[model samples]
Target: MEIDQAGKTNGQQPLFPTPSSTPPPPPPPPQISLSLKRLLTIVNCLLLCLGNAGGPIIVRIYFLHGGHRQWLSAWLETAGWPLLLFPLSLSFLYRRRSNPSAPAVLITPRLILASAFIGLLTGVDDYLYAYGLDFLPVSTSAVLIATQLAFTALFAYFIVRQRFTPYSINAVALLTVGAAILAMHASSDRPAGVSVGGYWKGFVLTLGAAALYGLVLPLVELTYSKAGQPVTYTLVMEMQLVIGFFATAFSTVGMIINKDFQALTREAANFGLGETKYYLVLSFAAILWQCFFLGAVGVISCVNTLLAGILIAVFIPMVEVLAVVFLHENFSIEKGMALVLCLWGLASYSYGEYREAKEKKEQIASPQVQTSAV
Candidate 1:
């Protein structure tokens, strides 16, 4: 047979064809529609509520088991739960280290300053919340605090990149109306031992905390998403933890210096506990746990997570009701009204989410037909 001109004279074919280096197809952009986003928001808010409610329950348990201030002081001194997160945070840091293609978010001094502001504001909000619980029923706190969702929506619209749709606006209005009714109920149900001034102070503190917290969330979210780094999330949370740790620590120290610590220890020790130090430790543990959970919420969605904390609104009121019933505290018609309004508002929020989700699904499906026809 004649040798083919295109073939190798030795009858050996090339090991590889001429390589055609075509660039890979670009990835599709993430599809985030308003409806889908709203659903995520509602879900996030619900989880936050549930997580937040746990904090009060833990505090109650620590005192019930004869905890004391020294223990709380020491627990805080140990670097708290934020220290515990070092491992996970390090893992995230390392994983991203080799990611050369990661999105560029300028971690400038300005951003760090903003992060600090958000952290400080967050600390203030939680400080007020913790302090208010001392004077007011958790129900009252939860009810008044529900206004945070409305406040957050406003902050997100003005500060964050999120555009407020008509539905979001209506959700805020409905939630506000429902929360106002709940607040009215709380006012009516105030116990005899709660001073008018104390009640008002608690009210103002909770509201301020909620409003400031509302502002903090979106900013942190903007920073973290843009930065795409664990450091930003860790940094903001660490600042809040540091601020909270100091504030609480100083307050505990003041109590010790003023001799209230000894009095509390003596009282708790009389219950046959060897010392009141255990109580303090347990209390610190509880707060530490709360800090960890709350920080996790921030990692997910700043504003949405806080709004989802309204889930606590549901349980907190019920928990308070149960505590009052057990302790022979008076319950009134307003509490009933408040609970009803809360339930109604929760249902409305859920319905709105469902409706939005359905719309998104329909839109996603409708696009397929047009694509096929084309």
Candidate 2:
């Protein structure tokens, strides 16, 4: 019998029972194996590292290959903001088609304001980073950017109430010391065509960029917490989309004010690698940066802000090595020592996390054991 007819025949009973009368549905199966998920996370993290380290290297290469337009390069790098639309659009399409009744992302005025502020900060940070890469060798710039770990820790503690264990403290101190040693050495061994003053200028700008971004990461975490929803990939992408939109807008304004758009034709014509290659490099750089952004956000959502910062810092050594091989930049003994210190700091943090997790597991098991004994 049809559901409606059965209900009518049964008088007060409905053929299609109310949802409350129905048995709950079984939970959905896991989308992937645990091991596969972990492997994918590892791959994503490595890609994040590559994109973070490689973007600057590409900019450095551009300059080396007669691309003197620093502002233009920076603006082009911000193009990744638009590329974010691809993923965001697909996510929206999937959700709308598959689960149209799902709650839409809450877009409060406060969220909009926060995202706009972050976008403005990101634009400034990008320009400063580009300025640093333009003036300093890739190796020096990488070491300097590693200082962001210390700044991030500081911000996370104050902003997000993140704890600072002995190991974390030690890690920060070692990273700070390593960066200082590298900066001290930067002055004397300036790269060809780079002046002592230029090196210092770049160092200051890079340091500023690092500090700004340090604050930005924690702020992002705080925003997510305030969003009043369970964290999901779609939500994360939504936040990134908003931030990228305003960031790109800010950069576009800068390009216009500085007339970089007008000079694009001349820069392209004079580019050492020709117009096609120049555009290709910029395009690749933008895409890689989007990967870096997505990876960082994914890590933050899955882990915590501190681990994201540590992962970036840990990859500094690899970036330095890549710089040496690809850019032919010098790798000094001091840099070698700095690399060791950074790795040591990373290991310390990892050990601390391991111990803490083990202790938590034991604590949870102890109560069960006691109950079973009784």
Candidate 3:
């Protein structure tokens, strides 16, 4: 943050750090093209939608089809990380082609460690989610997952001092209430073949997954702020690669310990979906989960963590409907009410953000207009 008479910092400022009492930032450099930024943002949103809508449903498909290894399911969540190397390598090649003097790798050691730690936590989150999905209906799980936005907002406020408008406060209340309403009749809609004890365990585990993931998103944004380098989509992908690797490794250890690797063949042979479809389901689950991480990180890089959480919440209903249509999971009246309330909450938060952004734009414009007139 050092500056000379030129009024420039010694290095590039990290992307989107929270404002402090320090002096105002120097004008932002012309970094990525605005059009490209928009395009990337659009692409990332689509990826987010794909993951949020498909990931749980696919993971549920595995469980519903007689796949019962929690570690295996968690492993699939990050196993497709190898898919990232293709683009990352190309980014390296492009960097080399464009600037011969630039470093071949963009990842820093500190960032690696940070990403690794988060990845470990992500592994735990994956297990919690998988455990919940084991017993809870996907429709039930989806509603609980939507409660994540409230947790995200809470964490964001503490971590980034994110300003909360009335709308967001209302959202937090509604989302919490929606989740609570589900809790009131948690045993009433238990999936067949699941005991009441198992149902409660799944309910608690799913909420734990939601809360942990809520923390993870804000932490990812915090990492970008402290990354000490320009945050770009490529760099975000690089960080994601590291996170995925570590998370997969963590789960791999569990799979080894639990003998899940050995159980896969037996599970596949007896899979209700058939052996061929079993492998296909696992493959799709891995790829889709990777898409989920990619989109989540990409959105965090493009905007902020809460927006990413909002995007995830926005797709929860889609996930719920998909669960009903594809998995034929139970969809009860309570779930319907929960979905309605969660959607109402999401809409409130979105409008609040839009309203704040518009007002801030007008304020900035008003100052410039007054200065010009003077």
Give me the candidate number with maximum lDDT: 3
Off by over 4 Å in 1: 1-47, 57-80, 83-115, 164-170, 185-194, 228-281, 284-316, 325-328, 364-368
Please write out the lDDT profile of model 2 over residues 1-374, one tens digit for every residue.
Answer: 43454454434566566556868875552355557656656766876787887887778878888787667666655568767667667867776787776445535677788878887788888888888888888877877788888788889989888888888788878877877777777666577888878878988998898898898889888887787756666667777767777777878887888888898888889888899998888888887777777777677766678878887887777777888899887888877888888889888988998889899999999999999999
Which residue pairs in candidate 2 have backbone atoms (N, alpha carbon, C) closer than 3 angstroms, thus clashing? none
For candidate 1, the TM-score is: 0.62
Candidate 3 clash pair list: none
In terms of lDDT, the poorest run of 10 residues in model 3 is: 12-21
Clashes of each: 12, 0, 0
Worst lDDT 10-window in candidate 1 = 70-79
lDDT of 3 by residue, 1-374 (tens): 56655444677654444455378765543499878988998899899889889999899888888888999999999999999999988988887897776677778999999999999999999999999999988777877887788889989989877777799788777767766776666556688899989998998999999999999998999999999888978889989999999999999999999999889899999999899999999999999999999999998898778778877876766776787799886666666776888789879987997898799999999999999999
Q: Give the candidate order by descending TM-score.
A: 3, 2, 1
> Where in model 2 is the C-alpha error above 4 Å?
1-44, 103-109
lDDT score, candidate 3? 0.86
Arrange candidates by lDDT, descending. 3, 2, 1
Better of 1 and 2 by TM-score: 2
